[model samples]
Target: MLGIALLAHWLLGPPVVDFSHHSALSPIDMVATAHAEVKKPLTVNWQTLRELDYTTGKATPTVLNLLGTDTAVRVPGFMVPLDDSADAVTEFLLIPYAIACVHVPPPPPNQMIHVKMAGEKRQKVAWDPVWVQGRLQIVEMASPYGEAAYILTAVLVEPYTD
Candidate 1:
Protein backbone atom coordinates (compact mmCIF):
# COMPACT_ATOMS: atom_id res chain seq x y z
CA MET A 1 0.00 0.00 0.00
CA LEU A 2 2.83 2.38 0.77
CA GLY A 3 4.51 1.54 -2.50
CA ILE A 4 1.29 2.20 -4.35
CA ALA A 5 0.89 5.53 -2.58
CA LEU A 6 4.43 6.51 -3.43
CA LEU A 7 3.94 5.52 -7.04
CA ALA A 8 0.76 7.52 -7.21
CA HIS A 9 2.38 10.58 -5.66
CA TRP A 10 5.30 10.33 -8.07
CA LEU A 11 2.99 10.05 -11.03
CA LEU A 12 0.64 12.80 -9.91
CA GLY A 13 3.21 15.21 -8.55
CA PRO A 14 2.73 17.36 -5.44
CA PRO A 15 -0.75 18.05 -4.20
CA VAL A 16 -2.42 21.17 -5.51
CA VAL A 17 -1.95 24.18 -3.27
CA ASP A 18 -4.20 27.23 -3.29
CA PHE A 19 -1.67 30.00 -3.44
CA SER A 20 -4.48 32.54 -3.54
CA HIS A 21 -5.30 31.81 0.05
CA HIS A 22 -1.73 32.30 1.13
CA SER A 23 0.69 35.00 0.12
CA ALA A 24 -0.08 34.35 -3.52
CA LEU A 25 3.65 34.61 -4.04
CA SER A 26 4.93 32.49 -6.89
CA PRO A 27 8.57 31.59 -7.29
CA ILE A 28 9.21 34.71 -9.35
CA ASP A 29 7.42 36.85 -6.82
CA MET A 30 9.46 35.24 -4.08
CA VAL A 31 12.64 36.54 -5.70
CA ALA A 32 11.15 39.99 -6.01
CA THR A 33 10.05 39.98 -2.39
CA ALA A 34 13.47 38.81 -1.32
CA HIS A 35 15.03 41.72 -3.13
CA ALA A 36 12.51 44.04 -1.55
CA GLU A 37 13.49 42.60 1.85
CA VAL A 38 9.99 41.56 2.73
CA LYS A 39 9.63 40.50 6.35
CA LYS A 40 6.31 38.75 6.02
CA PRO A 41 6.69 35.01 5.82
CA LEU A 42 5.90 33.59 2.41
CA THR A 43 4.64 30.14 1.71
CA VAL A 44 7.22 28.08 -0.15
CA ASN A 45 6.59 24.79 -1.83
CA TRP A 46 9.05 22.04 -2.68
CA GLN A 47 8.34 22.52 -6.40
CA THR A 48 9.81 26.01 -6.32
CA LEU A 49 12.87 24.76 -4.43
CA ARG A 50 13.38 21.93 -6.89
CA GLU A 51 14.24 24.57 -9.48
CA LEU A 52 17.66 24.98 -7.86
CA ASP A 53 20.56 23.37 -9.71
CA TYR A 54 22.70 21.53 -7.19
CA THR A 55 25.08 19.88 -9.64
CA THR A 56 27.24 22.97 -10.21
CA GLY A 57 27.03 24.02 -6.57
CA LYS A 58 25.66 27.28 -7.84
CA ALA A 59 22.24 28.70 -7.32
CA THR A 60 20.12 29.92 -10.17
CA PRO A 61 19.40 33.64 -10.37
CA THR A 62 16.09 33.15 -8.58
CA VAL A 63 17.60 31.10 -5.79
CA LEU A 64 20.62 33.36 -5.60
CA ASN A 65 18.40 36.36 -5.11
CA LEU A 66 17.13 34.78 -1.90
CA LEU A 67 20.53 34.36 -0.31
CA GLY A 68 21.41 36.69 2.57
CA THR A 69 17.94 38.11 2.58
CA ASP A 70 15.52 38.18 5.51
CA THR A 71 12.99 36.20 3.54
CA ALA A 72 10.95 34.30 6.09
CA VAL A 73 9.16 31.30 4.64
CA ARG A 74 6.90 28.47 5.72
CA VAL A 75 7.52 25.03 4.25
CA PRO A 76 5.69 21.82 5.03
CA GLY A 77 7.41 18.47 5.00
CA PHE A 78 8.24 15.31 6.92
CA MET A 79 11.05 15.32 9.43
CA VAL A 80 14.01 12.97 9.17
CA PRO A 81 15.68 13.35 12.54
CA LEU A 82 19.43 13.85 12.75
CA ASP A 83 19.68 13.57 16.53
CA ASP A 84 19.54 10.42 18.65
CA SER A 85 16.95 11.76 21.08
CA ALA A 86 13.70 9.79 21.32
CA ASP A 87 11.65 12.90 22.13
CA ALA A 88 13.14 16.32 21.50
CA VAL A 89 14.54 17.13 18.07
CA THR A 90 16.74 20.13 17.38
CA GLU A 91 18.01 19.29 13.91
CA PHE A 92 16.56 17.32 11.05
CA LEU A 93 16.14 17.10 7.33
CA LEU A 94 12.75 18.10 5.98
CA ILE A 95 11.76 16.18 2.86
CA PRO A 96 8.76 16.69 0.61
CA TYR A 97 7.51 13.17 1.11
CA ALA A 98 7.49 10.69 3.95
CA ILE A 99 10.01 7.81 3.82
CA ALA A 100 12.10 9.80 1.36
CA CYS A 101 15.52 9.46 2.97
CA VAL A 102 14.87 6.12 4.60
CA HIS A 103 13.03 3.39 2.76
CA VAL A 104 14.18 4.74 -0.61
CA PRO A 105 17.08 6.76 -1.93
CA PRO A 106 17.28 10.33 -0.71
CA PRO A 107 15.95 13.11 -2.86
CA PRO A 108 18.20 15.59 -4.62
CA PRO A 109 19.96 18.12 -2.43
CA ASN A 110 17.59 20.86 -3.51
CA GLN A 111 14.63 18.73 -2.54
CA MET A 112 15.79 18.33 1.05
CA ILE A 113 16.11 21.12 3.60
CA HIS A 114 18.41 21.09 6.62
CA VAL A 115 16.25 22.45 9.43
CA LYS A 116 17.72 23.71 12.69
CA MET A 117 15.48 24.87 15.49
CA ALA A 118 16.07 28.54 16.26
CA GLY A 119 18.32 29.27 19.22
CA GLU A 120 17.70 26.88 22.12
CA LYS A 121 14.25 25.91 20.89
CA ARG A 122 13.48 22.21 20.50
CA GLN A 123 10.45 20.26 19.43
CA LYS A 124 9.39 16.65 19.57
CA VAL A 125 10.06 14.66 16.43
CA ALA A 126 6.90 14.59 14.41
CA TRP A 127 6.14 11.35 12.61
CA ASP A 128 3.40 13.13 10.69
CA PRO A 129 3.99 16.08 8.40
CA VAL A 130 4.74 19.50 9.87
CA TRP A 131 5.20 23.08 8.79
CA VAL A 132 8.54 24.71 9.49
CA GLN A 133 8.53 28.48 9.49
CA GLY A 134 11.84 30.24 9.32
CA ARG A 135 14.36 32.32 7.43
CA LEU A 136 15.48 30.23 4.48
CA GLN A 137 19.15 30.34 3.59
CA ILE A 138 20.87 28.87 0.57
CA VAL A 139 23.61 26.98 2.34
CA GLU A 140 25.01 23.57 1.63
CA MET A 141 24.70 21.18 4.57
CA ALA A 142 25.83 17.61 4.88
CA SER A 143 24.39 15.02 7.22
CA PRO A 144 24.84 11.30 7.73
CA TYR A 145 21.65 10.79 5.79
CA GLY A 146 22.12 13.14 2.82
CA GLU A 147 23.21 16.52 1.53
CA ALA A 148 20.89 19.51 1.59
CA ALA A 149 21.14 22.59 -0.59
CA TYR A 150 19.17 24.80 1.74
CA ILE A 151 19.26 25.49 5.47
CA LEU A 152 16.29 26.81 7.44
CA THR A 153 16.70 28.35 10.87
CA ALA A 154 13.27 27.52 12.09
CA VAL A 155 11.39 29.80 14.48
CA LEU A 156 8.23 27.77 14.65
CA VAL A 157 7.35 24.12 14.08
CA GLU A 158 3.73 23.11 13.87
CA PRO A 159 1.70 20.18 12.67
CA TYR A 160 0.59 20.46 9.05
CA THR A 161 -3.04 21.21 8.33
CA ASP A 162 -5.06 21.51 5.17
Candidate 2:
Protein backbone atom coordinates (compact mmCIF):
# COMPACT_ATOMS: atom_id res chain seq x y z
CA MET A 1 0.00 0.00 0.00
CA LEU A 2 2.86 2.46 0.77
CA GLY A 3 4.54 1.67 -2.60
CA ILE A 4 1.22 2.20 -4.40
CA ALA A 5 0.66 5.55 -2.59
CA LEU A 6 4.17 6.73 -3.53
CA LEU A 7 3.61 5.72 -7.18
CA ALA A 8 0.27 7.60 -7.26
CA HIS A 9 1.86 10.71 -5.67
CA TRP A 10 4.69 10.69 -8.20
CA LEU A 11 2.25 10.33 -11.10
CA LEU A 12 0.08 13.19 -9.81
CA GLY A 13 3.16 15.42 -9.31
CA PRO A 14 2.23 16.23 -5.68
CA PRO A 15 -0.94 17.91 -4.46
CA VAL A 16 -1.54 21.63 -5.10
CA VAL A 17 -1.23 23.87 -2.00
CA ASP A 18 -4.60 25.32 -1.00
CA PHE A 19 -4.76 29.16 -0.89
CA SER A 20 -8.55 29.47 -0.72
CA HIS A 21 -8.46 30.82 2.82
CA HIS A 22 -7.04 34.15 1.57
CA SER A 23 -9.38 36.39 -0.37
CA ALA A 24 -8.22 37.64 -3.77
CA LEU A 25 -7.55 41.34 -4.00
CA SER A 26 -9.85 43.34 -6.26
CA PRO A 27 -8.43 45.27 -9.21
CA ILE A 28 -8.70 48.58 -7.38
CA ASP A 29 -7.01 47.11 -4.34
CA MET A 30 -4.25 45.72 -6.52
CA VAL A 31 -3.69 49.12 -8.11
CA ALA A 32 -3.62 50.81 -4.71
CA THR A 33 -1.13 48.27 -3.47
CA ALA A 34 1.11 48.85 -6.52
CA HIS A 35 1.00 52.59 -5.99
CA ALA A 36 1.81 52.19 -2.35
CA GLU A 37 4.80 50.03 -3.23
CA VAL A 38 6.18 52.80 -5.43
CA LYS A 39 5.34 55.68 -3.12
CA LYS A 40 8.95 56.35 -2.20
CA PRO A 41 10.54 58.97 -4.45
CA LEU A 42 13.91 58.49 -6.12
CA THR A 43 16.71 60.85 -5.14
CA VAL A 44 18.32 62.39 -8.22
CA ASN A 45 21.43 64.54 -8.56
CA TRP A 46 22.95 67.13 -10.89
CA GLN A 47 25.26 64.54 -12.41
CA THR A 48 22.31 62.45 -13.59
CA LEU A 49 20.57 65.48 -15.06
CA ARG A 50 23.79 66.50 -16.81
CA GLU A 51 23.74 63.23 -18.73
CA LEU A 52 21.60 64.93 -21.35
CA ASP A 53 23.67 66.71 -23.98
CA TYR A 54 22.11 70.18 -24.32
CA THR A 55 24.00 71.07 -27.49
CA THR A 56 23.10 67.91 -29.37
CA GLY A 57 19.75 67.52 -27.65
CA LYS A 58 20.58 63.87 -27.02
CA ALA A 59 19.82 62.11 -23.79
CA THR A 60 21.67 59.14 -22.44
CA PRO A 61 19.80 55.88 -21.83
CA THR A 62 19.61 56.70 -18.12
CA VAL A 63 18.23 60.17 -18.77
CA LEU A 64 15.83 58.91 -21.45
CA ASN A 65 14.38 56.38 -19.06
CA LEU A 66 13.08 59.15 -16.78
CA LEU A 67 11.32 61.10 -19.51
CA GLY A 68 7.64 60.11 -19.45
CA THR A 69 7.37 57.86 -16.46
CA ASP A 70 5.30 58.50 -13.33
CA THR A 71 8.47 58.02 -11.30
CA ALA A 72 8.77 60.56 -8.47
CA VAL A 73 12.15 62.18 -7.89
CA ARG A 74 13.79 64.42 -5.34
CA VAL A 75 16.44 66.89 -6.47
CA PRO A 76 18.46 69.28 -4.29
CA GLY A 77 19.32 72.68 -5.74
CA PHE A 78 19.02 76.45 -5.45
CA MET A 79 15.86 78.17 -6.55
CA VAL A 80 15.77 81.21 -8.80
CA PRO A 81 12.23 82.52 -8.61
CA LEU A 82 10.49 83.00 -11.93
CA ASP A 83 7.47 84.70 -10.44
CA ASP A 84 7.61 88.30 -9.27
CA SER A 85 6.77 87.55 -5.64
CA ALA A 86 9.70 88.21 -3.32
CA ASP A 87 8.53 86.04 -0.44
CA ALA A 88 6.94 83.13 -2.29
CA VAL A 89 6.82 81.77 -5.80
CA THR A 90 4.76 79.32 -7.89
CA GLU A 91 7.39 78.83 -10.54
CA PHE A 92 11.16 78.85 -10.38
CA LEU A 93 14.38 77.59 -11.88
CA LEU A 94 16.36 75.01 -9.95
CA ILE A 95 20.07 75.11 -10.52
CA PRO A 96 23.02 73.08 -9.34
CA TYR A 97 24.76 76.13 -7.82
CA ALA A 98 23.40 79.05 -5.84
CA ILE A 99 25.04 81.86 -7.84
CA ALA A 100 24.20 80.31 -11.19
CA CYS A 101 21.97 82.34 -13.55
CA VAL A 102 22.53 85.30 -11.22
CA HIS A 103 26.03 86.79 -11.01
CA VAL A 104 27.48 84.14 -13.30
CA PRO A 105 26.20 83.06 -16.70
CA PRO A 106 23.51 80.44 -16.75
CA PRO A 107 24.53 76.81 -16.93
CA PRO A 108 23.55 74.54 -19.81
CA PRO A 109 19.87 73.78 -20.23
CA ASN A 110 20.36 70.27 -18.87
CA GLN A 111 21.81 71.69 -15.65
CA MET A 112 18.70 73.79 -14.96
CA ILE A 113 15.15 72.70 -14.25
CA HIS A 114 11.98 74.74 -14.54
CA VAL A 115 9.93 73.81 -11.50
CA LYS A 116 6.22 74.53 -11.27
CA MET A 117 4.43 74.03 -8.00
CA ALA A 118 1.46 71.67 -8.13
CA GLY A 119 -2.03 73.18 -7.89
CA GLU A 120 -1.94 76.48 -5.98
CA LYS A 121 1.04 75.51 -3.91
CA ARG A 122 3.57 78.30 -3.41
CA GLN A 123 7.08 77.77 -2.11
CA LYS A 124 9.02 80.44 -0.27
CA VAL A 125 12.18 81.44 -2.04
CA ALA A 126 15.17 80.09 -0.16
CA TRP A 127 18.58 81.64 -0.48
CA ASP A 128 19.98 78.46 0.89
CA PRO A 129 19.72 75.15 -0.96
CA VAL A 130 16.44 73.27 -1.16
CA TRP A 131 15.12 69.86 -2.12
CA VAL A 132 12.39 69.77 -4.77
CA GLN A 133 10.40 66.57 -4.98
CA GLY A 134 8.17 65.90 -7.97
CA ARG A 135 7.63 64.23 -11.29
CA LEU A 136 10.38 65.24 -13.71
CA GLN A 137 9.52 65.71 -17.40
CA ILE A 138 12.00 66.27 -20.17
CA VAL A 139 10.55 69.39 -21.69
CA GLU A 140 12.38 72.47 -22.91
CA MET A 141 11.35 75.66 -21.15
CA ALA A 142 12.70 79.09 -21.98
CA SER A 143 12.86 81.42 -18.99
CA PRO A 144 14.25 84.92 -18.47
CA TYR A 145 17.13 83.40 -16.55
CA GLY A 146 17.90 80.56 -18.93
CA GLU A 147 16.50 77.69 -20.96
CA ALA A 148 15.74 74.59 -18.99
CA ALA A 149 15.85 71.15 -20.57
CA TYR A 150 13.59 69.64 -17.94
CA ILE A 151 10.42 70.65 -16.10
CA LEU A 152 9.49 69.45 -12.66
CA THR A 153 5.88 69.47 -11.51
CA ALA A 154 6.75 70.00 -7.89
CA VAL A 155 4.81 68.09 -5.26
CA LEU A 156 6.91 69.27 -2.33
CA VAL A 157 9.62 71.85 -1.77
CA GLU A 158 11.62 71.82 1.43
CA PRO A 159 14.79 73.38 2.79
CA TYR A 160 17.90 71.26 2.31
CA THR A 161 19.07 69.67 5.55
CA ASP A 162 22.38 68.24 4.39
Candidate 3:
Protein backbone atom coordinates (compact mmCIF):
# COMPACT_ATOMS: atom_id res chain seq x y z
CA MET A 1 0.00 0.00 0.00
CA LEU A 2 2.80 2.44 0.80
CA GLY A 3 4.49 1.66 -2.47
CA ILE A 4 1.28 2.17 -4.40
CA ALA A 5 0.59 5.43 -2.66
CA LEU A 6 4.09 6.70 -3.37
CA LEU A 7 3.78 5.71 -7.00
CA ALA A 8 0.46 7.44 -7.31
CA HIS A 9 1.83 10.59 -5.71
CA TRP A 10 4.70 10.64 -8.17
CA LEU A 11 2.42 10.18 -11.15
CA LEU A 12 -0.34 12.49 -9.97
CA GLY A 13 -0.06 15.16 -7.34
CA PRO A 14 -2.41 15.01 -4.34
CA PRO A 15 -5.14 17.62 -4.23
CA VAL A 16 -4.89 18.64 -0.58
CA VAL A 17 -2.97 18.03 2.60
CA ASP A 18 -4.54 16.83 5.84
CA PHE A 19 -2.93 18.88 8.58
CA SER A 20 -5.04 17.41 11.40
CA HIS A 21 -2.67 14.48 11.80
CA HIS A 22 0.73 15.27 13.28
CA SER A 23 1.94 11.69 13.30
CA ALA A 24 3.39 12.20 9.82
CA LEU A 25 5.39 15.10 8.47
CA SER A 26 3.62 17.29 5.96
CA PRO A 27 4.35 20.62 4.21
CA ILE A 28 2.43 22.39 6.97
CA ASP A 29 5.20 21.48 9.37
CA MET A 30 7.61 23.80 7.57
CA VAL A 31 5.38 26.84 8.09
CA ALA A 32 4.59 25.90 11.67
CA THR A 33 8.27 25.38 12.37
CA ALA A 34 9.06 28.80 10.99
CA HIS A 35 6.57 30.45 13.35
CA ALA A 36 7.49 28.62 16.56
CA GLU A 37 7.90 31.19 19.34
CA VAL A 38 10.62 29.47 21.31
CA LYS A 39 13.14 28.46 18.69
CA LYS A 40 14.86 31.05 16.52
CA PRO A 41 16.20 30.60 13.01
CA LEU A 42 19.88 29.91 12.54
CA THR A 43 20.58 33.02 10.47
CA VAL A 44 18.79 36.28 11.24
CA ASN A 45 18.15 38.86 8.53
CA TRP A 46 20.50 41.42 10.06
CA GLN A 47 23.49 39.14 10.18
CA THR A 48 26.22 39.83 7.60
CA LEU A 49 27.52 36.56 6.16
CA ARG A 50 30.47 36.26 3.79
CA GLU A 51 30.10 33.93 0.85
CA LEU A 52 31.89 33.33 -2.49
CA ASP A 53 30.50 35.47 -5.26
CA TYR A 54 29.53 33.56 -8.43
CA THR A 55 31.91 35.52 -10.65
CA THR A 56 34.47 37.11 -8.36
CA GLY A 57 35.29 37.60 -4.72
CA LYS A 58 32.84 40.17 -3.37
CA ALA A 59 33.37 41.91 -0.08
CA THR A 60 29.90 40.95 1.21
CA PRO A 61 27.30 38.52 0.04
CA THR A 62 24.21 38.07 2.16
CA VAL A 63 24.05 34.51 3.44
CA LEU A 64 20.73 32.72 3.29
CA ASN A 65 19.48 31.03 6.41
CA LEU A 66 19.29 27.30 6.59
CA LEU A 67 16.40 26.53 8.88
CA GLY A 68 14.50 23.29 9.51
CA THR A 69 17.84 21.50 8.97
CA ASP A 70 17.03 18.12 7.47
CA THR A 71 13.26 17.91 7.42
CA ALA A 72 10.36 17.16 5.13
CA VAL A 73 8.81 20.31 3.76
CA ARG A 74 6.27 21.46 1.21
CA VAL A 75 6.05 25.12 0.33
CA PRO A 76 4.48 27.47 -2.20
CA GLY A 77 6.96 29.89 -3.76
CA PHE A 78 7.98 31.66 -6.95
CA MET A 79 10.61 30.17 -9.24
CA VAL A 80 13.77 32.10 -10.09
CA PRO A 81 16.19 30.87 -12.69
CA LEU A 82 19.84 30.10 -12.15
CA ASP A 83 20.04 28.66 -15.62
CA ASP A 84 17.78 30.44 -18.07
CA SER A 85 15.88 28.17 -20.36
CA ALA A 86 12.68 28.35 -22.35
CA ASP A 87 11.15 25.12 -21.03
CA ALA A 88 11.82 21.92 -19.06
CA VAL A 89 13.90 23.43 -16.34
CA THR A 90 15.63 20.84 -14.16
CA GLU A 91 16.99 23.24 -11.55
CA PHE A 92 16.14 26.75 -10.30
CA LEU A 93 15.77 29.00 -7.31
CA LEU A 94 12.43 29.04 -5.51
CA ILE A 95 11.95 32.26 -3.58
CA PRO A 96 9.24 33.23 -1.10
CA TYR A 97 7.86 36.12 -3.13
CA ALA A 98 7.15 36.70 -6.78
CA ILE A 99 9.59 38.84 -8.76
CA ALA A 100 12.08 38.59 -5.95
CA CYS A 101 15.23 39.39 -7.96
CA VAL A 102 13.55 42.07 -10.05
CA HIS A 103 14.03 44.97 -7.67
CA VAL A 104 17.23 46.96 -7.18
CA PRO A 105 18.43 45.06 -4.14
CA PRO A 106 17.58 41.36 -4.09
CA PRO A 107 15.62 39.87 -1.22
CA PRO A 108 17.57 38.47 1.70
CA PRO A 109 18.97 35.00 1.16
CA ASN A 110 16.85 33.55 3.94
CA GLN A 111 13.77 33.92 1.76
CA MET A 112 15.12 31.87 -1.12
CA ILE A 113 15.11 28.18 -1.91
CA HIS A 114 17.33 26.14 -4.23
CA VAL A 115 15.25 23.52 -6.00
CA LYS A 116 16.11 20.74 -8.43
CA MET A 117 13.29 19.00 -10.25
CA ALA A 118 13.63 15.23 -10.30
CA GLY A 119 11.79 12.22 -11.72
CA GLU A 120 8.36 13.00 -13.12
CA LYS A 121 8.47 16.53 -11.75
CA ARG A 122 10.83 17.68 -14.51
CA GLN A 123 8.05 18.65 -16.87
CA LYS A 124 7.69 22.01 -18.55
CA VAL A 125 6.91 24.71 -15.96
CA ALA A 126 6.06 28.36 -16.37
CA TRP A 127 7.60 31.18 -14.34
CA ASP A 128 4.45 31.21 -12.20
CA PRO A 129 4.20 30.25 -8.56
CA VAL A 130 4.49 26.57 -7.75
CA TRP A 131 3.93 24.35 -4.77
CA VAL A 132 7.09 22.32 -4.31
CA GLN A 133 6.88 19.13 -2.25
CA GLY A 134 10.07 17.56 -0.95
CA ARG A 135 12.71 17.64 1.75
CA LEU A 136 14.15 21.09 2.63
CA GLN A 137 17.73 21.25 3.78
CA ILE A 138 19.27 24.19 5.58
CA VAL A 139 22.59 23.99 3.76
CA GLU A 140 24.31 26.63 1.66
CA MET A 141 24.23 25.97 -2.07
CA ALA A 142 26.02 28.39 -4.40
CA SER A 143 24.23 30.32 -7.11
CA PRO A 144 24.84 33.35 -9.30
CA TYR A 145 22.99 35.71 -6.98
CA GLY A 146 24.24 34.29 -3.71
CA GLU A 147 23.69 31.11 -1.73
CA ALA A 148 20.28 29.56 -1.26
CA ALA A 149 19.62 28.39 2.26
CA TYR A 150 17.11 25.68 1.44
CA ILE A 151 17.74 22.94 -1.08
CA LEU A 152 14.81 20.83 -2.26
CA THR A 153 14.95 17.75 -4.44
CA ALA A 154 11.40 18.15 -5.58
CA VAL A 155 9.24 15.06 -5.71
CA LEU A 156 6.22 17.01 -6.87
CA VAL A 157 6.02 20.40 -8.54
CA GLU A 158 2.49 21.60 -9.14
CA PRO A 159 0.95 24.92 -10.05
CA TYR A 160 0.15 26.83 -6.88
CA THR A 161 -3.39 28.07 -6.08
CA ASP A 162 -5.12 29.62 -3.10
Query: Tens digit of lDDT per residue, candidate 2, span 64-107?
Result: 75655567889999999999897999999999988889754779
Comparing 2 with 3 on TM-score, the higher-scoring candidate is 2
lDDT per residue, candidate 1, 119-144, as tens digits?
99888999999999988887889998
Please tell me which predicted candidate would have the highest TM-score against the true structure: 2
- Assess the local accuracy of residue 60 in candidate 3 as a C-alpha lDDT between 0 and 100: 41
Each model's lDDT: 0.79, 0.82, 0.58
Candidate 3 whole-model C-alpha lDDT, 0 to 1: 0.58
Q: Is candidate 1 or candidate 2 better by lDDT?
A: 2
Ranking by TM-score: 2, 1, 3
Specify the poorest-scoring 10-residue window by lDDT in model 3: 37-46
Better of 1 and 3 by lDDT: 1
In candidate 1, which residue ranges exceed 4 Å CA deviation? 1-38
Best by the lDDT measure:
2
Off by over 4 Å in 3: 1-71, 119-121
